[model samples]
Target: GTDMGTARALRRNLEAGADSFPQDVVELMGYFQPAGDGQRIRAVPGEGEQVPIWILGSSLYGAQLAAMLGLPYAFASHFAPAELDHALEIYRSRFQPSKQLDKPYVMLGLNVFAAPSDAEARLLFTSLQQAFVNLRTGRPGRLPPPVEGYERDLDPMAKTMLGRALSCAVVGAPETVGQGIEAFVQRTGADELMVTAQIFDHAARVRSFEILADVHKSLSEAA
Candidate 1:
């Protein structure tokens, strides 16, 4: 959540040589100052790397900054989708061209819990539901094991919060997941998707991703 000027200064430092350090970097003046011999201090490994910078946000602030800076924007829709649509709208509408990019680019976060069966996939998703509720209620701890009927036990407030926060999630078997993913992409028109899963079992987690990958491949082929 760095301010625009500070983020710009950091980017300049990373892309500039010691002699080319920005003189207007007030926030990090001392650390980026010239040496006794006259050469300005530079980010050793960072300098001249030309690393790609993507602005990530769960609110409108990040979208505006990324638009102004012409950087790719990523929305944290997996956990905070309340502002996803509005933020993307702001980013695309207010975007400016810059050396790094010529047009606005967007990547949306999504939670995918896939399994061989719809019932199994829904069961796997219970861990994330429990975890989200626990963290919001200030009882945060290690990821809990999946409970058979976790959603049925959540208080109304917690249920509503989860429903809104995780609105971008897909949970099902391969065919069901494929349909869900296609619908999401078509509705959002996102340039890219960043998928995440929170299954408790290690093997189940791995399998979830594998199923998602297969679904992605099928989608690509059909496209």
Candidate 2:
């Protein structure tokens, strides 16, 4: 997510101040090739061991980099959906097959808040909407408890922005969530969907995922 310089600085700070840099930290980092300007690192993990490199992006810049590097691309559509299609198109068209992949593989990030009833799911989703609003308003904190009338309290601009940013979110009952998943997949042709369900209640979060699993299983069986 950051450049090599930032990663190096972070590692150094971790080791110097907190002693938190693990020995395998180098392998866990990702940076761009400096293009013959500086010392080039042959491999991150070193010793010729195969390491999977996935490019995570929220816009086209990341897509182009991943395509150039011939790595799988993951788009953060869960919060940045406006440029998703354009980024995917660029990545697929310019993809250079590497040893790891023969074709462009796209992973889409999404939010899923599934419940037995639409009303409950909508209530649960308020947590994420509120979080997003707080983030946009520069007051981000831990996922807060769901508040009644939270979405309604948001102004028109906030509502529109959240609607666009979280366009990939699927929040509803099992059937509605299933339909949303199918529609998103059809729209993006994503090879994988990485889901985040950010409900504050632990039991409800688990149940949400369980309901999603059941919905996906039923969809698969029907297909």
Candidate 3:
């Protein structure tokens, strides 16, 4: 959630959330007492539910906080990957063991746009490219429909930014997607991968995941 405030205010809010998160969890698990009122509170259906909390981030702040709390960290590399390596290093090196987790666990975000043919997959990827460019150029709105040759129309700066931000994405046929997934995993050593796609057509979006699932099955069988 974007906080509408100054940097200091944002920091204060983050600190407050961090301090209260554990207490919230405890309250959800059963009992909590307000510091002021002499009353106990507990969530109705939430109490006694075993829920796991994972920290999601695209920067060092999230990594540091997750490490300090010994929670699993998920990097939003699908869109923002510039600080991924450094953030992972910091998290793993500084992790403190807690009751919930003992060792550092990392999940990486990846964009996969799979189709029957490479050209079709690339066409599907234009939607994401257009959306990203629109977002970076201060024209953020609902995701626009894909345009043919979207990158060709982009300015040099926009092109460069897109290349850098979407470097973690894989867009191609099954074979190409599989190879890209393998390369990304080998390079990052991520414990898990979170895949996302932003194809314009609903059927195409569904087909993309279907293709990815087949690719995953094939990879598993081969391994």
Candidate 4:
């Protein structure tokens, strides 16, 4: 559904006979550069009954627009870290209140993989890191088994960026990860946190989620 024309047509058809249907338009989250043809995107926000617009990005462009339009901003920090600081700074400085929010609201996406211990979490993270490396080298492939030497193999710059981005991620034992998440939320003041985990193994991914959920529960209890 990349076609705006098709979206408009669908909206018109859906509204034709519906009197009580929800008319609020939901624009799917997508990376949008502010300098790129933004007028078309601006047209999408007020299409039907002042639809809420969320500018999604891993960098500053999205934050700038979200602030300019007084809209919500969602950062794809889970996968990308470049320009993260610029994005947050721009969003906070330029934010203007709207009916939807009394002040600026920012949501950050994180990659979380919680397990029994740090060693286990590292084992799970091996394949995820490898996948990223493969993508960087243009050898995109399915997640592979966790190997022993990924930490040593990554370039210094890449390793540094990954560490910074994952600063908010939940890893290690449940108790340890719960503490990390609590500190992350406190530091970032993110209203919402979206998580994406990749462990190469589907069942292991599920287990990772389960462990994180339990950590959340533990944190709630502690709170």
- Per-residue lDDT, model 2, residue 35, is 25
Candidate with the larger lDDT of 2 and 3: 3
Number of the candidate with higher TM-score, 3 or 4: 3
| Reference-based lDDT, each prediction | 0.84, 0.83, 0.85, 0.73
Off by over 4 Å in 4: 1-51, 153-161, 164-168
lDDT of 2 by residue, 1-223 (tens): 3367667855665567324322223324333322233433334434245557788889888888778768899999998989999999999999989877889999999999999998899999999998998999999999989887888888899999889988889999999999999999998999899999999999999999999999989988999
Ranking of predictions according to lDDT: 3, 1, 2, 4
Give me candidate 4's TM-score against the actual structure. 0.73
81-106: candidate 4 lDDT, tens digit per residue: 66766788899999988665667888
Error of 1 at 146 (Å): 0.5
* Separate clash counts for every candidate: 0, 0, 0, 0
Question: 40-106 in candidate 1: lDDT tens per residue?
Answer: 4455555455556778899998898788778899999999999888998899999999777999999
Error of 2 at 169 (Å): 0.5
In Å, residue 51's CA in model 1 sits off its true spot by 0.8
List the candidate 3 regions with Cα displacement exceeding 4 Å: 1-41
Residue 218 lDDT in candidate 1? 94
TM-score to native of every candidate shown: 0.83, 0.80, 0.83, 0.73
The count of residue-pair clashes in candidate 2 stands at 0
Clash pairs for candidate 2 = none
